[model samples]
Target chain A: MSPLSRRAFAGAALASLLVACGGPGTTTGSSTSPPPSVSEASVPPPAKSVAALGRSVPVGLKIPAIGVDTSVMQLGLAADGTVEVPPIAAHDRAGWYRHSPTPGQTGPSVILGHVTVGSYGDGVFRHLGELNRGDKVVARLENGKSAVFAVTAVQTVAKADFPTDEVYGDVDRPELRLITCGGPRTGDGYQDNVIVFATLST
Target chain B: MRRTGLSAMALACAAVLAGAVPAFADGTASPTPVPSRSAEPTKAPSPATSAEPTRAPSDDQVSVRPSGAPNTGEVTPSSGSATGGLIGGGAAAAIALGGGVFLVRRRRANGV
Candidate 1:
């Protein structure tokens, strides 16, 4: 096979393996299972970065425009401690469960989703990258409550400016932040995270 | 607290990935780690939130449903466009298995 055909086949196969490897994240819910529960008692003490919130809380996620939906799973800090991806594909609607902060609580309920995939044009969060200020950001917790937050601000930060505090900072009110790799694609992935900061609208 | 969370996150990541490595004994795991950019840091922020809210417990029912749930229509592969549903790691790697789309990625950016 030509290099182009070979690469295409390889990429498809690898993605399939990842699906089988991760598959409906034990933490993130897929269409098949009931949403997982997020009990503070079950979750370990907060570590650092969103990764420490080891349990996945989302049952299933949806976006209006793109037909992206996949299982949600809990992702722990990686071997190197970086936050894990949504375990499976479905980039158009793929999102990360901000494992630490509880939904409808005093802190920010953060989620990182994909804006676009390397090849797929309709990544789960592609429109997430298009969200304007005042757009609605909603999250349903495993406990069965859906908290709605309004987009307050949107910015693109280089991977270096993760804004650890700002994104997952201590806040007295319930807040939400949506983050994804943004800006020019660096041959491999995005160079920065497109951050959409939202606060509970009610 | 933020610094601490990042570190904990890294450790948790290690645990998660290590758990997956053995699973890869079946060679089920994909080889795309190096291909994607890192998405998180290595530290923590502060006091954690318990699942049981210290706040009004009764008002928490709204947490169950996601703001949006995936509708099958949005991500399905159509008649003309063959590759639509693939999301992050797994999907990308799946494509690699067939030796398809990603070949273009390598060529699109010779420097990458």
Candidate 2:
């Protein structure tokens, strides 16, 4: 083969290989599906309802008040002992901490999402600050059951002073904490984390 | 003609090396580290000296929901995708290296 053709073939082959080897768990920016609108008045009152699964694994999250309906990805801890966030490419998806109790379990189940991705624009939780007390947050479990939670409070605390105990504290009833970076942007990143505390309503 | 063969071999080798770099880097990167907190000793706390008592909510106020049905369906865990990435990168590196070696051997055999 001629030198030019040979080089061209090699370049094409390398490019194809790179595209094929693109990592897993990396979203292609196409998986995000629009969520349905839920209104605060439409939400039912809290009830002692049974969950669908004994150890329900949350697969999706929906907060109608803030217009958030996104798939949930399970996240493990990073090397630095901090919870891992979803890839920047998947800013539309929320990540649930796998180490924590599954939603509907008798402990705090934590769900995290990015507030904003650098250039791609607002993240899944960009409007998380708008959630108010008594808003409904629904977690759809893998077992086809849903865990509905009622927002009790929304607090924006400095990341330096994260209330780890309060967020992850053991509870007799199932609880949920939706976390995202918020407050003010600083040189490092978002200075504060917005945490919404919720209890299993049904 | 010999110079052309040498140039082709060199280009193939460079491509192989370039492909191998990412796989090598991934091989060196360790998996997520698990925290080790079991070494700390559990100590009994002394009784509170403060006059203020910790308020405990009444059982009636606490709501306990029954566990839902015992469905054993398993959801795939999501943490192993990084390993899949490493494997894909390694396979790409191997294929690139093998192609380079085959090209070099063909050129030499052809006496070009």
Candidate 3:
């Protein structure tokens, strides 16, 4: 090739090399299973961040959108030092982590439910993955008032990669997190945890 | 001229291979280290402020930070796949190879 053509080719090559090496992130392969449906597409962005309400113990929860209506029980730490889950026998009922802020209080209030209760079949949050953004989740409090939350996002993350900070971390506004086992079950148990994030809407 | 082209091809391949090594490393998901509660700084109020009856202690004050998730799943196997790296890597490698050939020829013509 002519010297001019050669120089042009070298410049092109350098550009390509930079582009290739520029982003090693492209090497991340597609997951074996389809990526967890963690879309925030439908949920409309809040016009304004919701204000927090006064503290009150959550007595019950209702997610009419996904048909989750269950009494909320209190959950403390287990012997293993992890947050507790609702009893396996009453897996249909949801339990709120007492350590977390109450439903209407500032910071994330966590609620845990089961997808399946052994042979008992579908649990209360079996359809939690179906919740979309803009959907409503109502938490009845001991003060005889209810806190309404709008779903912001739903994600199915590997149990090992459970987003502890995002789930339990403090937030300025009152927020709610619904957690349950999801994804294909392996010999160990459910492979992932389905988390639904919501912010106080009303 | 042919020698220059071959040398350029070799250099380009080496660059591509070198780039591919990191790509492979990046594809595998490393186990994330779980944080311990003891390692975290305590957010409790000082003793002087603990006994105030006028203001109820917040939930965080009364409660200990949870160590980890309350997940029921254990020993869940991770299935990581390695792909997509080739598409971008290959295209970039080809362009680099072309560039390498040109540069090599230019250098060879200059008799350096």
Best by TM-score: 3
Predicted candidate 3 versus true structure: per-residue lDDT over B6-111, tens digit per residue:
9999999999999999887776533232234433433233231343333336444224456765664333133211223455677788787777777777778767
Q: Whole-model Cα lDDT per candidate? A: 0.49, 0.65, 0.73
- Backbone clashes in model 3, listed as residue pairs: none
- For residues A157-177, write the lDDT of model 3, one tens digit per residue: 776777888788767788889
Score chain B of each candidate by TM-score.
0.24, 0.31, 0.27
Better of 1 and 3 by TM-score: 3
DockQ of each: 0.06, 0.04, 0.15
Docking class of 1: incorrect
Candidate 2's docking class is incorrect
Cα error, candidate 2, residue B106 (Å): 82
Put down candidate 1 lDDT per residue, A26-106, tens digits, no spaces: 223332232121111111222222221222266555433334344344433433435545533544344444453544555
- Model 3 spans > 4 angstroms off: A1-31, A34-47, B1-63, B72-112
Candidate 3 CAPRI level: incorrect
Worst 10 residues of 3 chain B by lDDT: B74-83
TM-score of each: 0.44, 0.49, 0.57
Best by DockQ: 3
